[model samples]
Target: MIDFYKYQGTGNDFILIDNSKDDFKANKVDYAIKWCDRKFGIGADGLIFIEPSTKGDFLMDFYNPDGSQSFCGNGSRCSVAFAKFLGIIKDQTNFEAIDGMHQAVISDKHVKIEMQQYGAIESIGNDHFIDTGSPHYVAYRNGVNENIVEYGKSIRYSDRFKTKGTNVNLIAEKGDRNIEIWTYERGVEAETLACGTGATACGISFAQKHNIDKGIIEVKAQGGHLRIHLEASKNDKVYQNIWLEGPAEFVFKGVIEDEN
Candidate 1:
């Protein structure tokens, strides 16, 4: 039997397991593929493992539904909340991920995470590309009536990103400080409720295109809403101090008796 927790951040759900004692010995990739199956298993966008961290409060190991390593934005926030539940962290904590170290603050209702810095965004044709922990292709999309899956997949598997692949996001500016985004995550290979990194990328990219240096943008996704704050260097093209803020909730807790 195994114990697990279900957590979600703005509808980006994950199956979390405490492996501090190395209790899980099964093949992680195979297990993720099985348990993340929507119909057959726990059914989540991804899986997260919490292990003791010598570098910080804990280590967040994130895997995509396809069993690939990833640094998920929403999943990372959920990990911070999970660490608090396990009594390993307080309101504010730092954790190491596949990408690097990250800091987060847990309030009474929301989790705000400091994301890594990003370099200049590359503009190709009508699209833009940036790596916000994960690679994302951003395009300004107008209106809501379109085939998201087909359009996103075409860009996701394009020859330019055939090597590592990239997440696809279609965004439309709604107001001066608000935008609506739809993301087709690379790992999930489909449109999800929301994507943290994708939202962050879109916000920053939009700011750059508009020549805005620093500000906050409200991103509305299918799952929920997220706030992305960005600061850019006037002399340099790099963007820094990016923050992603949203809600993280505990859905349920359970144990799996079938060790299959």
Candidate 2:
């Protein structure tokens, strides 16, 4: 039997298990789809199993709701919280994600995640393409939820990203330093409340498009609010510290002897 905890960051929720001994084998996609079922199972956007790492503090082996992906950003934030809950690390922690090893710091209520530095943002037809550990299509709009899903799905399922459908993010600039965002995750096939990497990508992409320097930008999502702090860089080397601060309350803990 395995004891697991549920955590959510701005509505992009997940099921987490502390597999510190690497004794768990969840290599099947059907398992994730079944476990992530909202009505029939634990109900989450994805699932994560933490294992002991020889290269870092921990290793986050994650999966999407569709039982496909592993490098989920919001899931990673929840995993950080879970790791803290298990006393695996302290205020600061480092873990290897599917993309790579990520560093983060846990405050009283907020968590500041230091993401990896990828390449410069790319411009698509009417949007910019950036990979915040996961591919994202960012389009600034006056308001989201207006056919954004319909508009984003074409791109998400298109040959460009069909193999691993990309996450769609719609961002609306509020003020000089605030923004409202809505996201459509690939695996979940809907608009989730918050997307940690999506929010992070939009924050920096917005900064680049607007030419804003270092500042804290609020990303208001359907689930809750998240804060992003970006460091303006020259020569397209922008670095950032994103905080997916929101509810990570425990929902329920139990054991599943038979994962059927």
The digit string of per-residue lDDT tens for model 1 on 1-260 reads: 88889999889999999987656778889878988989999999999999878898889999999999978999999999999999988999989999989999999869999997556788888788988989989989778666778888898888988779899999888988799999999889989999999999998888887777888999998999999988887644468889999999999998877663
TM-score, candidate 1, is: 0.96
Over 4 Å off in model 1, which ranges?
A: none
Model 2 stretches with alpha carbons more than 4 Å out: 26-28, 237-247
Task: Please give, for residues 1-260, the per-residue lDDT of candidate 2 as tens digits.
Answer: 66778887877778887889877775547667877898988888888888888878998888888887747767777788888888898989878888887888887756677765477788887688888888888887885547767877877988888887788888888888788988888888887878888888888788788777677777888788888777776655456554444445456686756442
Best by lDDT: 1
lDDT on C-alpha atoms for all candidate structures: 0.89, 0.78
